[model samples]
Target: MKQDIDIPKVEGVYVAIVNEYNDIYKTQDWNAYIINDNDDALEMVIIVTDGYSEDKITSKFRKKIDVLPKKSYAKIELMQEELFAVNNQFKVTYFKGNTMYDKVYTFRKNTINLKALQPVPLMEARGVLVK
Candidate 1:
């Protein structure tokens, strides 16, 4: 029965941690985003995020999006500067058509700094993207 179960692979979806200027706050801040690079739309998307290290752990949070349009992205949350020293993890689950798929994206400790930014797909700003 295990072999008969078709667990579809998740593709073209990613989580990015971006450092951008916040107009309202008048400072640069790190933010998390969910990018849907697939041609098909995703429904009932959920993302659970947290940060942890050997001696410290941040609070866990969940975000739900009813629909993520094809080739689009949504802001999930803001990343505290101190959390960058710990491992940040994001578990993303969503439905494509009638099938379900999920994936976990992680940013290793001290790996989310500005020097590691790259051009993110479907987004004008650059950030650290995990595929």
Candidate 2:
């Protein structure tokens, strides 16, 4: 048996982006986890699991900071040092019925776009990685 773990409650935000070009059978969904929120900015983390299709590909960079109240569509660049230094390690794992795949990616600086500022159900909304 595994012991239960208590995770600290950190103020954060949840953002979800839907690809405009998704077809009926397959819809592309991208999520951004922005934790440690403050007045001016929030810590953003993006994790991607599937890369078999162009619409499903995502960057492995972590710990990005996006200034709040940004312009409707602006680009924010992320640095590797800042991402990894914050104790964030890029990890990916996928499991099928009888097969499992796991991989780790090298840290690389990347940029993500802030799509818009909108209202989310229960948290602050910060749209990112709009394609």
* TM-score for all models, in order of appearance: 0.94, 0.23
What global local distance difference test value does model 1 have? 0.93
For model 1, residues 16-110, the per-residue Cα lDDT tens digits are 99989999989999999999999999999999999999999989999999999999999999988888999999999899999989888999999
What is candidate 2's local distance difference test score? Answer: 0.30
How far in Å is the alpha carbon of 42 misplaced in model 2?
2.7
lDDT of each: 0.93, 0.30
The TM-score of predicted model 2 comes to: 0.23
lDDT of 2 by residue, 59-97 (tens): 444333333331222222222222322222233332222
By summed lDDT, the worst window of 10 consecutive residues in model 1 runs over: 1-10
Score candidate 1 by TM-score against the native.
0.94
Tell me how many clashing residue pairs each candidate has.
0, 0
